[model samples]
Target: MSLAVALALGTALALPAVAFADADDSDNLMRKKRFGQNTGTVTTNSNTGGHSQESGSKATTETAVISDGAITPFITADGAAAMQAVADKYAAVVAQGGWPKVPSGKLKKGSTGKGPAALNKRLFMEGYLRAEATEGEYAQVFTSATEDALRRFQRNHGLSVTGVIDGPTLGALNVPADRRLATIKANIPRLAEYSKDIGNRYIVVNIPAQQIEAVNDGKVYSLHNAIVGRPSRPTPVVMTPLTVIRFNPYWNAPASIVEKDIVPRMTSSGASKVMRDMNMKIFNGVGGPEIDPDSVNWRRAVVDNYHFRQEPGGSNAMATAKIEFNSPFGIYLHDTPEPHLFHTGSRFYSSGCVRVDKVAILIDWILQGQDGINSSRIAELAETKERLDKPVTNSPQLRVAYLTSWPTRDGVAAFRSDVYQLDGTGFVVGQPLPVGETQGGKRYVLKPIPRSLEAVDADEAVGFASIFRRSSDRIDASERLPGASSKSTDSLVSLKDPKAKLKAQGRDTGKKKSKAASNGKTRAWTGNRERSASEVMSMPDADGTTAKKPGSKKVASKKAKSGDKSKTAKAKADEKAKTTKSTKVVKKDKTEVAAKKPDAKAVTDKKKALTDATKTASADSKSATQKSNTAKAAKPADCKAGADGKLPAGCKPAAAAKKPPAKPEKTAATPAKTASSTN
Candidate 1:
């Protein structure tokens, strides 16, 4: 009995171990099906699946996967809940009658128009105006209540809150309820996907809305306006930890900007003018000797081959601070010199980087736990105008996303325009992963890399000048003001050799000769001939020594001959007219004789023939009337006895007459006597 109990205990322990092995195998199969093969190496966890540690390293790996699933690192639980509430509210609004559209015009205080009534109705539906405040049939007057309601609506929709129904306000109000609902539904999944595992502290940048929020402990710590990337150079969606914040950092212009923007400006505006105005310096290469602006060939030196660095100052492109983050696309957040852009309704004007408003506040928040860095230290650095680097000990995670609809913590849902169209139905998927090494030790396959500026064709490297110069060159010289110099002509002259200069002068003389000929000037030719006395008498003498050009004398004589011939032709035409008049008179006389009256005997014969015809017609009418009466009298009665239905004697109906067959025509009779004589 003891031996049997020991075997049973051992079998039970083995069964649990076998079951665990089966579960792990199943998990591996599911992962493979979802994400394909495990081509990448996975770090093992020393604690739980949520956390891991590398061998001999204190750095812990924060697993992206949360309790539910792997998600974008930026979304928070409170944000997702807020979005759900907004979606539900908009759905209910759709169930009821949707919001009314305000008319397409401006509405200010004291204005009495139909647009004001519509605006009031919209505000009431959106819960910005009280029902009692909108009393009356028309509500056409734009009262104080209406202005206050408009202000609230604008604030909620991320507008300027001007308290007037301006163009932007009217546009936001006119968006249909159905579209708003659809936008909410489309973005709800995105919120759920990205907001799943966001920790207690992080930053959220919404590209479509151009806003950023720093959240801590389920609440917004600070909010600021942002200027994101333009459409052509869109800001990429990424989630990475920001590691450093630099004060008064230098701006290294990217290669693309140098090739496309700076090069053209330098070429047109002159290198010295551009560098001085922009506070930029040209270097031979990275960390190489700084070159004098005048020494470089502004016209021929390729901008892509050189490096441009802007000095750190208040006037620099990146105004004062830069927040460093690891991204393969080389993107980051920084401050800008143009702070007025933050007040605009739409602020997408950067070249793939984000420009944050109130960047000092953000830096202070990011460096909360760092050594020797705080708001006071930042202020001191700004006053002194000194460049300083501050490393963030507790680096916060940043998620840049394109979300058009979001909900506030108070359960108020707001919808923004889909500027980037990233709500799944957009042309692009999400922000594309960067091409090179990513933050999580993963590499993304991207399209063929863009060719370097040096690799591009020489003609193409000139950019806009190569495309537009030819068209500008075609403008006529006469259109320019008199005495104005032509830059292109001057450049051409400066480049020409002395031999070419002489040839150009000869060409100009030939052009003048053609112009004289076109003006009808006469040319003189010389020959070995003696001048006759008559020729000399007819021609005009020049100073009594030289005669007039022979060409001019010949032209004058030809004109005289032509005049005499014209006179002879006119005389012949007059003589022909006289002959034609005489012939017309003779023809008229013959026509009068032909048009005389008809003969008298012919008229008398016509009258006699008419009388005979009248008498014959009267006799024929009398005979036809007598014959019709006799036929009517001889008609047979019905073949029936009166009221007895018996046949009458000798009253048979007459039979219809049959037509006789036609006879053959007779042939000409043969002349037998003539035939006998011929024989």
Candidate 2:
């Protein structure tokens, strides 16, 4: 035997025998194919009791099919092309820093060759093959060493114990090599979404794939396969902000779960000591709620109001550990004695909660891997040798999420069959960013938009109109003053009021006043504002520019004429007032009876004076009109009245008045005194 095979023998005891045997055959076959030889043969032969077998040394040689720098042996037209393509793809992968070609040398002990070296790296990455130590001199890959590692890798990646790098193994290692990395990146973001925000430490349950990761200090410290809720009772995705953890927790058997799964089984087995074995308390007949383990009928459970829960422990009938958080989602990561479930690939077979594989390891991680509770402590707990009460010093954060497609640190993206079919839109699987756009510290995301009222309500149109009217009322109130504090209050007051119209009118007037004051101008104060009504009215026409419609431009001629008519009317009003005063003085008795108070008498007297003033003003206006008419009649006389009040040069007399018109008093209401107090 060669020295290489001798070295291989030393390490054979530590590995499974099937691995090396499979590896030798695979390597030989691959090497022969690479060297452009016909390595395989096809034959059809049959020998039976009823049939005669032809025995001859007749050898049929296999043919080599060559194409695109590859040779396929003993393959037909279609099969040859496919086999060649696979070989070419593998060759390309080997060339890319991905895989390695075997070398001709003396095989060393515990050393993997190029192809196995790449395979080992991948295996270690997938968490199947681990490095026991770095002290050994045989720390590399050779034939025998490669076979051992491949054997372990195959076992961990859920493949059969055959250590050969078969087509399936090759496909997994080569295609989309970045899957693990993509999964990690994609899941990290999804985890962030799950946590609502990242927590200092959190527990994540990847339900579909049956894995749990306890993350602390932004690193994965403890990971285990978890048995989660089943399809019928799927573990809900929740973000529980953990605050406390109880040692020896009570397993509260949810009623729905108990009815569907546990009750029927318990009926078959009487008062099973399963809960008692876990150090739980049973409330079998407590509070008049009877759970006759062997006799209770499950068919009436749904309609029944009685509940059954495992009490907190001390040789109690409940689960041994409990974790408390603030989520309405009744899910907690807890330890289970049934550790065999972790050995399976699909762990979603629980009743709406997570059952962790290494519960002690997770607890230690929660305590930040504190001293005195090391591997020794964990081993003791597993062996049931340690009965001491181990309580957590501080609570750790726990985040629970439903990840259908989770990733590994090395970039292998794992996709679970959507057990719940929860990805309704199929969007939650691979999204890296939030669907919402961030703006002004607020994220506008794609929330499930609510259905319109019209779609839900029978009297939708009436409700819409009512809401619109109420909105209008609110707008009017807000535009003016303190708005209706509440819609209900305003509605109540409107309903209770005896005179809605008067109240509404008062509100309108207040709004108008508020609007006028709030308009572009500042409020007029006592010392700074002293313009009278008449003065303000006349101010707009003061400039030679005519006061046209706000947007128009009228000439000075129109303005001057309008001003002349107003001056003439004011002069006639003064003259009429003088005459009315003389007539009212003669009838003092009647005037006294009409108005007793000075303010009241002034208002009454003003009405009389106003009538006389209107008549005199009309007379003055007609005089001005007549004068204008006379000017037209005497155009040849050049009748320009100078300061002397006489016509310059020769002038003709104006035309006579046509008729006298009646006058009506236009009384203005006196301003009411307002008494308002501000504190």
Backbone clashes in each candidate structure, one number apiece?
Answer: 1, 25
Highest lDDT scorer? 1
TM-score, model 2 to reference? 0.35
Whole-model Cα lDDT of every candidate shown, in order: 0.55, 0.39
Q: Candidate 2, residues 1-679: lDDT per residue as tens digits?
A: 5322332233223222101000001111112111111112222221100001011121111111111211111111132233333334334444554433333333333445454455555554444445532114333553454566555433323343355666544544554434323333333334335544445566666665456655544444444556666654455554434544444443445443443344433433333443333232334432454444323332222312444444442322113344444433345666553444455545555555666654655555565555476545554443442234444556554545555443222222333445654443322321111212121222211121122222223222222334435433422111111221223232323634656644544454334444333332322111112322322222222123322232112334445555665565565555455544543232224533333223556566656665566666667767877987986786864576779888766665566977644332222211111000000
Alpha-carbon runs more than 4 Å astray in model 1: 1-75, 92-97, 102-151, 162-167, 289-304, 343-345, 421-679
Candidate 1: tens digits of C-alpha lDDT, residues 497-592:
875675445444334334333323332111111233334333423223343434666555666655655555555465455544542232223433
Top candidate by TM-score: 1
TM-score of every candidate relative to the true structure: 0.50, 0.35
